[model samples]
Target: MQASQLSRVLVVGASAAGLTTVESLRRKGHTGPITVLGEEPHAPYDRPPLSKQVLSGAWEPERAALRTREALSGLDAEFVFGDPAVALDTAARTVRTRSGRDLAADVVVIATGVRARQLPGQDDQEGVHTLRTLDDALALRAGLLAAERLVVVGEGVLGSEIAATARTLGLDVTLAGPLAAPMALQVGPLVSGLLADLHTERGVRLRLGTGVAGLDSRDGRVTGVRLATGEALPADVVAVSIGAVPATQWLEGSGLTLDNGVVCDSRCRAADGIYAVGDVARWYHEGLGRLIRLENRTNATEQAAAVADAVLGDDRPYTPVPYFWTDQYDARLQVHGFLPADAEVDVVEGDPTARRFVARYRSEGRVTGVLGWNMPKQTRLRRQEIADAVAAAPAH
Candidate 1:
């Protein structure tokens, strides 16, 4: 297949991955028709800042946009705003949108990202929120300003970041989760322990290894979390960041693999002329010899580019060294490769006690991952090492 062979391309989800696919296609000399359908009415924007600057009131919502009118104009693609795709017909090569419009296409790229998972028994409440979209950040920011006590459930990157930002804003925030330490799944126990210490030192209460028995509220407004241990922690605001569920429900009958996300081949092809990218795509990694899905901003862009190439008839396998970063309080953590909580750790540079260091994670004598805390320069330089380690990972 070539650019000429593709007459029209339909990209679902007008997000970073979807917009990047359109840009990549145009840059690769693709002159075919392209249509982008977004669920949100706002223009595509960067989501990383929603948990940090936006929540902290340091950056406006417009500043987080991925493209301005001028930038999007150069892509020469049809933009469909506020209309979400509702169904996919793999055999007929068509898509149905919520507006009752059936779109035909020569190729389709599904970039439907994930949505934040809410806790059970949680409903639309004044003080309860989940940070995923710009609207979420705006609402949470306002909620934070008015509330004196904040309870953040789930101590993952998003929860921890929100806690840090809330604490910086002078809110009494209690960070609670089932994990022994925050971000232990991403950087191992040693680094996670240091993060626990950092948050405790910054006046953010830590309530690890706890489950919410219920949410206390007044007149349908969440006020605090009631622990399963028969204790109540009072709060004025609540944020749940447990995890995300891929937005792949619309693909249910499309004959596509839906395990965690839209499972794709090495080339990111989900089916005969269809592809998937971003957080909703769970593609096979040749290096890892396993199926993996990443929810990071960096992986979204890289995978979109690879999906674009694959749609253009390039069958090169997409194999990237997994990377993610989080800035909590005064600590900045960057990681390359995969680091499970149980992996053995080896100090690479600096020291954890100093709150600034880099460490390599190993499994069965092979360097499987790397972690950097407040070591941005060193972290960027360690990518090659991660790639090398991935290439040398043992066969399944």
Candidate 2:
């Protein structure tokens, strides 16, 4: 399809990526009809603050709003809120909604994102929670205030942030996860150890190296979790941040390759006149020479802009350096590049003992990534260096 030939563009989500796509299209001189379909009843809101500021009572839920009512109205887009795209026909270029409404468009952007993963029998309990939506944050915040002991059942970014915020609320918090150390996959062993020490020093108990076997409940509220180690941890509240899966079940039999996410080309194009972005898209990366799907907020916006460019006839490759950030207690950790859980890392600046440091991750003796623990300026300065190193290094 040609850029000028485009008429109506349908965005299947109302989250960051989808809204940014709508904004980008307008900014790029696309004078076309844009309709944003949202599955949630509430307006689009920032998600990162849900686990930290919103839970800690530092930021009200409304503070996470992405745009004001007037700002959204200025975009000149029709919003079909509280309805989801249940199916799509690529040949017909039509999307079927849950209410049996058929909407056809000249182009489609899939930014459905992901949903929180839950454990078996978790819904049988009441006090258990997950922090993904505004309602989830509100419920968890109330549970945090009323509970004496809280167990966060995933030591990843969400769980760690919630544990830290719970600690600030004076709740006896325990962090349980399968990882040997917290955030080992994100930063590195050195920084992970530093984070572990920070949590321990803040009076948050760590229960690492095992997953939850089962959850115990009484009177419809979760009491505690039974560990795989055959030990029971008591808790008055539980937040299961086990992770999330792409919300692509609606695309079943839609002829899209569905793996961890909707598979797309390097340009973020899934099919003719179709594009994917955000956590629901697993696009091939020209720089990394691999397929990557990132869940970070920055990645969502970057990919959305790239998709918008693609829609407007920019044939450039959509490759961006992966970046993510997490705030726990008073520390803000930022990372750029891919450092898997098993990636070998060596500190190149400062020391982890000082509560501030920078670590460079290397694969096959070449720097591939860098992480900053309160070293924002230094880390930002070294990004170019790492990109150069990655370009010069031999492909693995």
Candidate 3:
């Protein structure tokens, strides 16, 4: 079916996904009134560097924005900042912002991205922080500069990066998580074990298989965290980043499926006249025959492009491979494609002790994913091979 020529398109969320969707719409010849609403006070910007560059105080928040006002103004798209979406009236085709303004649109794309999951009863305490937005990073960075003891909760990509960053600032840092190692979900058990060893060698306390019960605070400032085992880890600051939930609280009453994230077909379309993208959208994989939600920036841009095509009468679904990267303590790790839990892992080159290598994950002799440490070129080649294989697979 040919999509109606979009005249009034409202994109809620001004980050990578929302901005990309609007830009794609304009590039595809949709010269309608496109209004982009962002809860962040700043315009859309890049986020990958927030932990490495911005948190180190080497870069400012402006450097992270994807597009400047001049670039956005050139497209004739209206930009609204600092007003968070409070509710969505899908039936009325309007959205209500916290500022008491109603935004009407012929089509609405929800790109309200996820935020870092904060610890309950601790998230609001001073010196306890979560890093997702620019403001969050600024606060955490400030704390890190003066902090003597830093406790990072979670061994995921963000948490590891934060631990590395804290150590770079000469802070005594401890990395703790529920898992036995770091990046176990993606790089698998073996690689995660090596990573734990690397952190320990660098004088960073790697506390694995432990979970936080609560944050101990006095006078509204965090003093330490209590462990699930009834032990205490004293810290001047704590950063919790277990995972992120979709920013779909405003669409709670909207008549669309909300399972973990907004469920959408390949093209990013959800309910009638509505679409969801970024970390907030759960996508259906035809090959895997399952719904998957990805938090990578690449997926966000690809899905946003698909959303633009869907809006312009194209039915192309986002079927790209998932890829992510992390930088910890001078080591760079990159991965492409999804590796099944049962997949066999192959250590192609480099030893964990040497700290540079390529690993390939395969299932039944067919490559499923590739992990690279200082071998980005090889990783990309293997990833492309997997993508080709998936595309060439026969129809069921």
Candidate 4:
């Protein structure tokens, strides 16, 4: 594919992946008419900071932005703000906006991302919120400052981080989730036990294996959550962080493969002249031997580069090890590679009792993943080392 031939590119969603896609195309010397359609009025911002630093009041909302207005404007890319793509016409290769505007493109990149899943009957309540976008984080932070009791509905990274922040702000927080352990999804049962201990030590109430029945509202202001067992936990604010559902509802008739997210091949190609990347893309990982959708900036940045190369017909399969990091209170947890349920977990260094350490997960005598607490540099190096080792080994 010649650079001149790859013209008229239209990228939907101005999040990390979409911004990187446009910049990548230009960096590859493709001087096509690039247009970035963003649903948010602001330019691309760092999402991880929203739940961590911004909500903690250590960083402002403007500081969380990844791209400045000048930087985005200087890229020579058309910036369409305050308009979200409403529908997709795959047959015509056009996208319809919520304002009823139609945009044509030679190639379409779906980086619409995912929205934080909300509990039923929670959206309309005043004190009920889900943090995903900058607005959500700002509102949540404000509410947390005034609330005495904070109820978090999920035990994932976002939920844990928010609970940590709420606690730091002198608010009583309760983490309500179905998992028996806090970090069960990433670090297995043993590590989850360690994480739960940390939360309990911080005076956080852990309500494990509990399901929220609905939101208790007083004249549209959320006051508490009704548990499945008919018990009502008194709270000033309820945050629904159940998980995230891919924002692919607009692609229902788009004729692209979507299973939980936009299903793409290893090359990130959903169809001819169309590709999907980032958290919204579900692609097969050769190392893991399964289709997985990751919600990390590392995946978004790395996959964006791969998608760029694939669009240029390089045929480079994206096989980078999935990596992620989370900041909870004083501890920084970093994860590298994949953690399969069947893998054997081993403690590499440090003890969970001290609340800082590294752990390795292996499958069939091969190290498949690494979990590090307060070990950023080690996590970075180990991810590359694991990817190389996995590449050299025979197919399992």
RMSD per model, one decimal: 1.1, 1.3, 1.6, 1.6
Question: Which lDDT values do the candidates have, in the order given?
Answer: 0.89, 0.89, 0.85, 0.85
**How large an RMSD does model 2 have?**
1.3
* Residues 210-329 of candidate 2: C-alpha lDDT, one tens digit per residue: 878989989888989999999899999999999999999999989988999999999998899989999999998877778889999999999999999999899988868778999998
lDDT of 3 by residue, 146-252 (tens): 78999999898888888888888888988888888877766788788888887887778977787888889889999988889888888998988798999888888
For residues 48-160, could you state the per-residue lDDT of candidate 1 as single tens digits? 99999999989988999999899998888999999999999998889999999999999999999998999877775678899998999999999999999999999889999
lDDT score, candidate 4, position 327: 78
lDDT of 3 at 129: 88
Show pairs that collide, candidate 1: none
- With candidate 1 superimposed using the best TM-score fit, by how many Å does residue 115's alpha carbon deviate from the native? 1.1
In candidate 3, the residue pairs with backbone N, CA or C atoms under 3 Å apart (3 or more residues apart, or in different chains) clash, namely 45-65, 45-66, 46-64
Model 1 segments beyond 4 Å from truth? 394-396
TM-score of each: 0.98, 0.97, 0.96, 0.96
